[model samples]
Target: MDVVMRIEQTLDGALSEAEGAGAPPGLAAAMRHAVFPGGARIRPRLCLAVARACGAEDFSAAAATAASIELLHCASLVHDDLPCFDDAPVRRGKPSVHRAFGEPLAVLAGDALIVLAFETLARHAAACPERLATLLLCVGRSVGMPFGIVAGQAWESEPRVDLARYHRAKTGALFAAATVGGAAAAGVESAPWRCLGEKIGEAFQVADDIRDVAGDPDELGKPVGRDAALGRMSAARELGIDGALDRLDLLIGEAAESIPRCPGAAELRALIRLEAQRFLPKELVRVAA
Candidate 1:
């Protein structure tokens, strides 16, 4: 199957599983609402990309890993748009889960999706049981305490914040999971892939910060200027837009340098360059203009 098709199939199946066995109909619907019409599906795409770069032969396992990463990302977005956080009422160019389904259903939907992510991984363990532990570890560490997306959200409530740590946890953790988990799914040493994910994650955070400051909501398909309004730490706020852009460029360079010596290193680097272009709001705006 094509990459996009595989991902969509896995996601659809996983969501269906959540709706089974007397699951609440409204909650299931809200979960489906949060996941479908996904924006870019970048984390899963990166996961699959890294899996292929690492020469994944277990395509099923790789697909499961990629889909799980995307689920976690979608779950994060559902929670992030709750009334308590960044609550502007739109997501993926549509009413957010909370806005459309009510906050309680939205919460249930997010929780269900988080559980579903792990379930997807466990269900696919038969494809490559040996790597299952590592995959679970990667996913767990990316969403749990101390240094996951949970920690990233927790940072917002702190009296003082470490911006690098904040960004790493908030955005970079899952990217790290994608790269590392992808390699592990392929039965490769995940260590070499870690820095690439870290760099890419950080670069993404910088790009997102830039977009939050300067992007059009219509173009971005979501509200902009959120970081400032929420009084959150932002690369654009601290470094200035030009500096943040420069930093994003630098991070992509470093991410390219971090790619392991694999069969498709050169091609992967080229792909990274192409993905990097997608992150630049200025360039995107200029083209749109």
Candidate 2:
């Protein structure tokens, strides 16, 4: 199956299991709403790419890991849009989960998605618990405390924060998990792959910062100027528009270069270069530059 199809199928199947008999209809519907029609599906796709680059032909592990990461990402979004957080009213051009399902269910849906991420991984990894263990740890560190996306979110609560740490935890963590989890799925030693994912995550954050400042609400499908509104640190706020753009370019190059002597190293670099183009769309490039 194609990468996108593989991801969607896995996610659909996971949701099916989640919505089975005796499941709460409201929670199931809310969870399904959060996942379907996903944005870009970049994290999951990144998981697949890293696995393929590591020479994985059997994509079951990779696909499961991809689905897991995407689920966690969706969960994060659900919670992030709650009134307690960004309180975003819209997502992917639709009502935010809290708005569509109400705040209580929105919180539950996010929690359900988080549980489902691990469940999806476990369901697929019954035959390879050893590899699953590594994937679980990698996935855990991506979203959990201290250095995960959770920590990234928590950084906002602190009176003071470091930009690099905040960016790494909040935005870069999952990207690192995607890369490292992909490697683990393929049975590759996953540690060396961290730098590539970190760079990509950092680059993606910079791109998002740029969008928050210059992107249209219709195009972005959510609020802009959120960093300033929420008193959050951001690349656009730290570096000037020109400087942020330059930093993005440098990070993309570094990400491409950080490929860890894999069999598909050249192809992976090409992929990074291609994604870099998508990150800063042509119009944005013109506007921001």
Candidate 3:
């Protein structure tokens, strides 16, 4: 199977297990609705890429870690699209979870997905106790209060906030987790590799910020101007369009440069390059033409 198919299959299995015997009616379907209609699966793919670079002895563990991260990401999205947050009516080109399944179900589905992420990770750890513990610790730190996506969302409510810190916590945290979790799965715990993950995470956030401003809703499958509309701090708000693009370029370069120190750095580098192109300003492309 192709990498995407393999990852999707893994995710599907985990989701199924999460909805076991007594799962509330419609809940499983709602959760599946929020998750599977196909996304780029970039975060999990990145995790696998990093693991391959590290020469992971057990690809299954690495793949499990990747799926776990994606589950957590989906959970975050369900919550983010709720009326209390972005209030977005659509997601991935469909009605938001709350819109499709009612607010209560949507809330439960998000909560379930979060629990599912940990469960998936724990299942992977059964084979490698030490590595599993390390992965849990890293994933916990990246998703927990004061430093994870939760913290990132909390930033929106705070009266005073730092834009970079917000971006790092909200979006960069998962990217960091993906890299670190992959490394842990591979049993490779080196300082340089960890730093590579950090850089890539930050770059991913920067690119996301750029896309918020430059990307079309049809393409992104979610509301675009919500960041500005909600008065939330964003790279575009602080740096402006041109400046955000420049920052994205710098971040991508840094991410790519860090790859040389990683075992499977070349593939990671190529992936980063391809993703970077996605964020390039259309004007820049037109200028080159």
Candidate 4:
């Protein structure tokens, strides 16, 4: 199967497992709703890409990690779109989870999906315990306190916050998890690879900042201009569009350079380079230049 199909099948199977057994009646459906019609599946694809670059013998473990990362991502979105946060009316071109399922159910659905992420990883741990543990830690750190998505959300309420810190937690954390977790799953333990993850993560956030300012709602599948409208700090706001784009290019180059000295590194570098185009309109690219 193709990359998209392979990712969809893997995620679908995991969602099915999450739906089965003793889950509350509507909970499974709600969780499924949050995940399907997945956006780009970039994080999971990154996970798989890193795994491949690391010479993984079996893709199953990395696939599981990818699915788990996607689940956590879905859960984060469900929460982020709630009235408490972005209060977004639509996601992936559909009604937000809270709008479709009601607030309480939406909250439960997000919670359930998070649990499912950990469970999915646990099920695959037997084959690669150390890697599994590393992935779990990386994901948990990226989703939980201090420097995770949760911290990202918390930053919105703080009286003072750093733009870099907020972007790293809110956006870069997961990208970091995706790359590092993928490497761990492939049994590759190298500091340079880990640095590559961080660089890519930062670049991903810069790209997102650009998208929030210049991307169309139809293209982004969510509200644009919300960041500036809310007075949220962003790279575009701090550095101007051209400056932010330059920063993104620099970070992407850093990410590409950090790839290990190995046979497949060139392909991995190419993938990292493509990430610079995310949510960037062709016209905007010209205007920003």
164-230 per-residue lDDT for model 3 (tens digits): 7887788888888888888778888734555566677776676666777777778788778776787
Structure candidate 3, residue pairs in collision: 53-264
| C-alpha TM-score for every candidate | 0.96, 0.96, 0.92, 0.93
Q: Which candidate gets the maximum lDDT versus the true structure?
A: 2
Lowest summed lDDT over 10 consecutive residues: which window, candidate 2? 280-289
The sequence of per-residue lDDT tens digits that candidate 2 reaches over residues 1-289 is 8899999999999999999999989999999999988898999999999999999978999999999999999999999899988889999889999999999999999999999999999999976778988899999999998799889888878888887898899889999999999999999899999999999999999999888888888877787888899877788888978899899988988888889988898998888788776776467553221
lDDT of 4 by residue, 167-208 (tens): 788888888888888888888773456678778778777777
Clashes of each: 0, 0, 1, 0
Model 3 residue 101 CA deviation (Å) reads 0.6
Q: Which consecutive 10 residues in model 1 have the weakest lDDT in total?
A: 280-289
Compose the digit string of candidate 1's lDDT tens values, residues 189-280: 89788899999999898889899988888988898888787777788999998898778778888999999999878888988888887876
Cα lDDT, all candidates:
0.88, 0.90, 0.80, 0.83
Better of 2 and 4 by lDDT: 2
